[model samples]
Target: MTALDPFTDALDCPLYVVTATAAGERAGCLVGFASQCSIRPARFIVWLSKANRTYRVAARADRLAVHLLGHDQDHLARLFGGATGDMTDKFTRTAWHPGPGGVPVLDEAPVWVVGRVQSRFDGGDHCGFLLAPEAAQHPGGDGVRLMFLKDGPDISPGHPAD
Candidate 1:
């Protein structure tokens, strides 16, 4: 395997806290690998590391909610990004409610969307979940400036698969 440095290629893409609830259990995590993949039909995709607890929950989820973090929401980013759901309850520390398909929608987020899982693909260490937007809510704001690489704690992936 070729070792490529992600640090050099790390773009300041929007950061999101993606949550999925299945079988009465909820899981969430900070996500960086996501984007709008289609314009005509308005489709988006979020990639999750297989080792993440959120991925395990999302695998059985019919829908997933994506919440964009504002510039000052570093704590939200820490709960989902710096901490691992395997050992901690990330949801208990955040404000959220059940949304479409019972997925957890972060209340503090300025913008959020719930989408039905359209397809899933294996991307080696991560899995790509293509979503079809079913519902969206944009609570008015300055369109919260997205969190980036330089904004939060630099924690190493707690799991081996990450």
Candidate 2:
């Protein structure tokens, strides 16, 4: 048997800023564990850390927005990935508007998708939110976004989202 990290370590994946709103509160965090799991019905899944505030808010949220980070958007990545939302209102510093079901949509993101959570699964240290795509936008060219292990940019693990 082989440890998972040995295989996962070499995989390069895109980072996303997942946002959710519920009970008059908005929360978002940078996520690396997400993928499109189905094609016929077009389903996606994003795994949120159990320790983050985003997960807490998403627990009650019906919709979530996933933002695609561009190569030049490392600042947004840092803002969502490093700083803890417990202290700062990340919305005040960034440009965004309330989207479907009050989900916060980052205005700077060139590409984004809004999905309704179809199901939730407990994935040990994380909770997987299965999303059913409702809306999406592809407004830019192939500008490389941040990739784990590929860029390996200096970023803190993450802060809470709710």
Candidate 3:
């Protein structure tokens, strides 16, 4: 662990699911490394693991969708996080519809945003996708509890984190 672990370990931010479509193929995965990086003019970034199938698809995709999971939506998180897309068809197991640029938008998410890929930053074992909001769906949260990192440290990553 890096020196940042002391601070990072105590953190339990909300989890998210990111989906993308390219060349008629779709992919998505559980993401813990994403955040809004700008306020004025609005910008958000999603870091996709190089080992994830979604990352490969997103590399060729022009747009992507980011869905926020409610605290009680462990099943949704597990489905995205527990299995590799190489072996499982995640969309078939969940409710979703095509959104702008044909990105898959999760139906059960309380909030979701579709963004045009502004740029790509390839670094380390993951590439950061800089997104500019294109469209969004806000069903309006009524006590929508969000999912966090407390799902247990042993939670198997859909793909090995390496």
- Per-model TM-score, in order, reads 0.89, 0.91, 0.94
As a whole number from 0 to 100, the lDDT of residue 17 in candidate 1 is: 86
Model 3 over residues 1-98: C-alpha lDDT tens digits?
A: 89999999998877889999999999999988889999987999999999999999999999999998987787888889998999999999999999
Clashing pairs in 3: 70-146, 70-147, 71-145, 71-146, 71-147
| Arranged by TM-score, best first | 3, 2, 1
Q: Who wins the lDDT comparison? A: 3
Would you list the clashing residue pairs of candidate 1? none
For each candidate in turn, give its C-alpha RMSD to the true structure in angstroms: 2.2, 2.7, 1.5
Give the runs in model 3 whose Cα sits over 4 Å from its true position. 151-154
Off by over 4 Å in 1: 1-10, 140-143
Q: Backbone clashes in each candidate structure, one number apiece?
A: 0, 4, 5
Q: 70, model 3: CA deviation in Å?
A: 1.1
lDDT of 2 at 117: 97
> lDDT of all predictions, in order shown?
0.86, 0.85, 0.90
How many residue-pair clashes does candidate 3 contain?
5
lDDT computed for candidate 1 = 0.86
